[model samples]
Target: MELLRTKNLTKVYQQGKHTVNALTDCNIRIEQGEFVAIMGPSGSGKSTLLHLLGALDKPTDGNVWFDGKDMYSLPAEELARIRRQEIGQVFQDFQLIPIMSAYENIITPVLLDKQKPEKEYVEALAERLQIKDRLHHFPAELSGGQKQRVAIARALLMQPKLILADEPTGNLDKESAEEVLNLFIQAVKEAGSTLIMITHDAAIAERAGRVLRIDNGRVTG
Candidate 1:
């Protein structure tokens, strides 16, 4: 089934006197449980598109439909709720709380929702991601790969419908990158979640079931 759709999606930014068109008249559809990789060069509006799709920012023009609902048309509180409970995001920078242990970081979303953490599920997820041993370590104490794994676990903790990953392996070494990516793909597939990942590397893109290329803020494929 179609899980996400965008029509004439556009975003504009103003930097001083310059009007920057980050994205323009883009339309795309993503299906449930499909893995999609988006490729683009620097300043190509790849991240901008991801942010818009994930409901992190509002588009200047156009509409986004997630799960058959017009996301941009929803009220602010409803949109925020959908963003929190339905979409999961993983960043290249390993956006974990430095003060929290790896385990705490993984369960942060649940805590944010004011729900009790499901310890069994969290531990199983950590084990699957191979981060169970590192759970007690804080972000500062974990290696780059470990940190990213923790981030992935956090993203999957809520069993979100969509997972948005932005250059998730950019900070890791070749071996670690492959490891993390494999684990990530397996975890997402097992959860039957749709994945939209941004990757600059062609090799990485090839791993996805489908690839979408964006250039000058437009989706080329």
Candidate 2:
């Protein structure tokens, strides 16, 4: 089943006097339980595409469908709710709350929605990702890999239909990066979550089931 579909997606920003198109009529579709990597160079539209698909932005001209529902058609509040409840985001900066413990950060989404985290599932996931012992620690106290693991844990907490990650391992060492990427791939597979990741690393992109090459606001190859 198609988890997400975008038709003629376009994003534009005014850079002083010139209007730059970050993404230009780019059509894409991601299937359920599929791991996809959107790869491009620094100026390409990979990040823009990810943001569009994740419901974080309004496209200049296009529509995003999430599980057969038009995401853009919903009210702002409803869209935000869907992003939190049905879509998980793993950001490049880790985005963990500085004051909260790792456990608190991971389950923050549940709290925001007035729902409880599934304790058993979370515990098992943390153990598998090798971050069980670091739960009480804050992001400031964790190693790079450990911090990313905590971020991943938070993304997995919702059992989301789609996981949208933007350079998830960009800040970690090679070994740590591999570990995080592997964990992401495994979690998406095991949890039946669809994944759409943006990366500039070819090695990391190769791990995805499908790799799309984007450049100059379009798929070049």
Candidate 3:
């Protein structure tokens, strides 16, 4: 039931003579339907690890496997397809298309893949996220919290195998932040989906089933 597994995963960035090792010899397993959080200070490879998990970037060494298939072993086109179908990402910046409404932004994946949106499931997700009424509104017309809710709804609309959130609530106020995190918890619990989140907030990290800290690319005590 390991939805995600990584072994001896490492990432090194060569900047002139000094080589920066973002991650090193790290191994972690996340079970299905689990909500896990990764926490660390800046430059601790928190984002790097999340990126690797989401297949956004390639690892310098070792392997990342989803189910039984090696993620990095796939061809670039296959990896892209897997990223779209199996993994969903919620970024801190709320990367919504400025011209698109909430509804359009959320279903862009389906449209791009030449598949029709599953209307019933998508509506349920929007209602759960409390963004049903705001579907027609552009990102510019929504509050910071509302935008994030829309982002969350979009991520869930696909019913993806795993969702990776990077500092999802970092830009919101306390109440808004709590609302977003609660929505994430509810989604994973209710839908039986897996989540891997990166956050610097200890309070938020405490809500996860498992919390692993990364420092100098290694899981720390």
Task: Using lDDT, give the best candidate's number.
Answer: 1
lDDT of 1 by residue, 51-120 (tens): 9999999899999999999999999999988888899999999999999999999999999888999899
Runs in model 3 deviating more than 4 A are none
| TM-score against truth, every candidate | 0.99, 0.96, 0.96
Report the poorest 10 consecutive residues by lDDT, candidate 3: 183-192
Best by TM-score: 1
**Candidate 1 lDDT score relative to the true structure:** 0.95
Higher-scoring candidate on lDDT, 1 or 3: 1
- Candidate 2 per-residue lDDT over residues 82-171, each given as its tens digit: 988999999999999999999999999999988978878778989878899999999999999899999988998888999999999998
lDDT of 3: 0.88
Q: In model 1, what is the error at residue 112, expressed in angstroms?
A: 0.7
Model 2: CA > 4 A from native:
none
For candidate 1, the per-residue lDDT at 100 reads 90
| Model with the higher TM-score, candidate 1 or 3 | 1
List the pairs of residues colliding in candidate 3: none
